[model samples]
Target: MGLIDHLKARLGPARGKVSDLAQQHGDKVQHGLDKAAKAVDEKTKGKYSNRIHTGTDKAKGAMDRLAHKDEPGTEGGGGSGGGDMFTPPRTPPPTS
Candidate 1:
């Protein structure tokens, strides 16, 4: 197998564990993220507070997605179910 495949094979279990933990403690994770952002914002004197908040929000969103990856109807593309990791999300065509 290629290097990427070998690495994925080794890390698959770790990724699954992370997903399970994300699902189990998602609220706590989000809370911790908010607390950290608040601490950093205070330390920075609100200079980068907006950016920090944005990043924190994105991180939380990503965590939520990972936590819900196996739930029905949670796919980014609204997929039916069950596919490999590389399935492409369907996109709508642009209006003229």
Candidate 2:
């Protein structure tokens, strides 16, 4: 196997553990992101509210992806060496 494959083999457990943790603590992580964004918005007197909100949403989406990275049928199977098909839903644009 190549170096990348070797590393993946070695780190598979760690990656799974991280994904589990992310799934378990996803809400807390998203909450912290929101809190930080709120603080920044406050500091900036709401001048950057739109940008901050957009960023916060993006961050939450990333967290969700990470948390679900190891879920079965999502892009790759759940460590079972089987290929399962899963597609994420697209988010609609925010309405004014």
Candidate 3:
């Protein structure tokens, strides 16, 4: 096997463990993100509110991805390479 495959084989269990921890504590992680975002937003006096919100959303989404990454048959589970690129749209595309 190639180096990448070898490394993945070695680290697969550890990655699964990490994913389990993330799933168990996802709410705490999200709470921390919210607290930090609020602090930054307050300090900036809402000047960067939009940017902060976007970042916060991205962070939460990442946490969701991590937490759900190990479920059997779900997208992002070990095996298929198609999970990372497919996500349902959260909002309708803007009309011209």
- Candidate achieving the largest lDDT: 3
- Give me the runs in candidate 1 sitting further than 4 Å from their true place: 79-96
TM-score of 1: 0.73
- The RMSD (Cα, Å) of candidate 3 is 6.2
**lDDT tens digits by residue: candidate 3, 17-43:** 888988999999999999999999999
Task: Report the lDDT tens digits of candidate 1 across residue range 15-46.
Answer: 88998999999999999999999999999999
What TM value does model 2 have? 0.65
Sort every candidate by TM-score, greatest first. Answer: 1, 3, 2
Name model 3 segments beyond 4 Å from true: 76-96
Deviation in angstroms for 83 in model 1? 21
Which residue pairs of candidate 2 clash?
none
Q: Please rank every candidate by lDDT, starting with the best.
A: 3, 1, 2
Model 3, C-alpha of 45: deviation from truth (Å): 1.3
lDDT of 2 by residue, 3-86 (tens): 999999999999888888888999999999999999999999999898798778767766777777766675444543322223
